[model samples]
Target: MAPARKKVVIEGSVSCVYCVMEGGPGSVIKTDLLPGAVVKLQCNNSRKGSWEEQTKTGGKGDFSFTPVKVSSRGAHKCRVFLVSSPRGVCPLIISDGAVLKPAPPNATSPFQLFTLQPLYFYPAPYTCL
Candidate 1:
């Protein structure tokens, strides 16, 4: 008598670009959503309280969920409540299976550069497949 375990379903989603840049995924949003557009992937591991999973949006703007797995991992989040691009909630680029830090120096927001030959290392474009 031992057959009941399907709790470890921690799927999440909503990583978007909606279009106007022609980058990678689907790139074309002037207000056209119909590939799987329902838009709602609210998740919560901690940012406030209550928000298990809702799941929608799959037209390249994507959304997914299957939560039930929890052992206090640290942090987890997923949100995509669309309007035009970003309004209510949206956050899921995924990087929590492992390797959470050591890759956070690609920072560039508006402008901030002052290097006279001291520190600004750049060699990891994609070299550790």
Candidate 2:
């Protein structure tokens, strides 16, 4: 029998700012994730600086922070926390923030948010069988 393959996963994203600054809309949430999971957006921008924001998914299998504060810095990461999923997944904080404007509070989606990942989910590759 073929070796049991672990599903390709990305999760419980967290990181520490080595030498960084949060520009405008910093990394706040996971916009795409494995299905049947609860993606949680959490971060520690500074030792004392703190902010709280949240939004849930509806089995849509995609995550993204809405109404984020767009940012640009040397190394500050906008990471994702895979709240309730398998571990050792890819770093949701894949790269630096995009040069796009953040979503307005009156917006309905993350379309305009400055994102590091593709705003759309291609779930066809990962089937949780």
Candidate 3:
């Protein structure tokens, strides 16, 4: 007989801060806002539903997704992907391995909330032709 699997829910937020400084002279700084950016979640187990699900950032660059079912035997892994950027500035997913703690059989939430690492954007140096 096979053992029963547990239900789990995963959620997190995506946000970034853009800053600009003076090329020379003094230090003049400015922060650019990121909103409406598309982010996708990748799940190892397909039974939880579609492996490729997407969501968008809110006005404050916050995003989350629906819950998913995880396997009991193995450590389930899910990766975050960047679909598109509103300002044409794509950021990299720097989050390391995020492991979810198994839920209790009679758990109320049966879920885990992880803190996603910040996405960083590095400007490319320019050279005049």
- The best candidate in terms of lDDT: 3
Per-candidate TM-scores read 0.20, 0.32, 0.54
Best by TM-score: 3
Q: 4-123, model 3: which lDDT tens digit per residue?
A: 554444444444434424352122233344578777766776455546577888887767655444444432566666666676443433444344443444544444344454343322
Clashes of 1: 1
Which candidate would rank higher by TM-score, 1 or 3?
A: 3
lDDT of 2 at 48: 34
Worst 10 contiguous positions by lDDT, candidate 2 = 5-14
lDDT of residue 29 for candidate 3: 36
List candidate 3 stretches off by more than 4 Å: 1-9, 15-33, 46-50, 69-75, 89-108, 126-129
Clashing pairs in 3: none
Steric overlap count per candidate: 1, 15, 0
lDDT of each residue in 44-76, candidate 1, tens digit only:
555465554344455554443334433213223
For residue 20, model 1's alpha carbon misses the true position, in angstroms, by 31
lDDT of model 2, residue 72: 29
lDDT of each: 0.30, 0.33, 0.49
Q: What is the lDDT of residue 78 in candidate 1?
A: 41
